[model samples]
Target: MREYSYFVYLMASRWNGTPYCGVTSDLLRRVVEHREGAAEGFTAKYGVSRLVWFEQQSDINQAVLR
Candidate 1:
């Protein structure tokens, strides 16, 4: 089995707030970027900065399809 570093994650504004689904290799950095509003996008606009769920995949294809 080859090593991989892909992740599918979910971010939310609050426990019941709107959820945002995404994929990234660096989960920490991505979350931080979202929190800091590094880019003006969906997560930033909807305040979906809280990590709610995550799962790793073997590759980008798998991660994206997930």
Candidate 2:
């Protein structure tokens, strides 16, 4: 079986601006997508693209609970 890792991340539009929280397996790719506005959603609308914080988890449950 393949090993799986998860992440909890925080994104921001600008310093002292709006904040966004997310979880993903590929943090780098996800952040890039947000910056490029790949999806027409909350992140794109508010321009929440900067990766300000992140944490990795070995278990999905652990990631979500915190």
Candidate 3:
């Protein structure tokens, strides 16, 4: 049996400001990718790269809901 962690994360430009919501299986890698602008889309366009908040879920569906 393999254990997997799903994360619902919020990224912001600065403290208490515009936030971006996302979910990923690898939170650290995903965050790093966003910071590097490797993620093609809104995050890359808007430059949302700072991690502000995150939540972990055992299932993908639960993480998506979060």
Better of 2 and 3 by TM-score: 2
Computed on alpha carbons, the lDDT of every model, listed in order, comes to 0.90, 0.92, 0.91
Best by TM-score: 2
Q: Model 3, range 1-66, lDDT digits (tens) per residue? A: 998999999998777766899999999999999899998988887889999889999999999987
Q: Which tens-of-lDDT digit does each residue in 24-61 have in candidate 2?
A: 99998999999999968899999998899999998989
Alpha-carbon TM-score of each model against the true structure:
0.88, 0.93, 0.91
Alpha-carbon RMSD of each model = 1.9, 0.8, 1.0
- Candidate 1, 1-66: lDDT as tens digits: 768799999989989999999999999999999899885878878887899999998789999999
* Pairs that collide, model 1: none
After aligning candidate 3 to the native by TM-score, how far in Å is the CA of 33 from where it should be?
Answer: 0.4
Which residue pairs show backbone clashes in model 3?
Answer: none
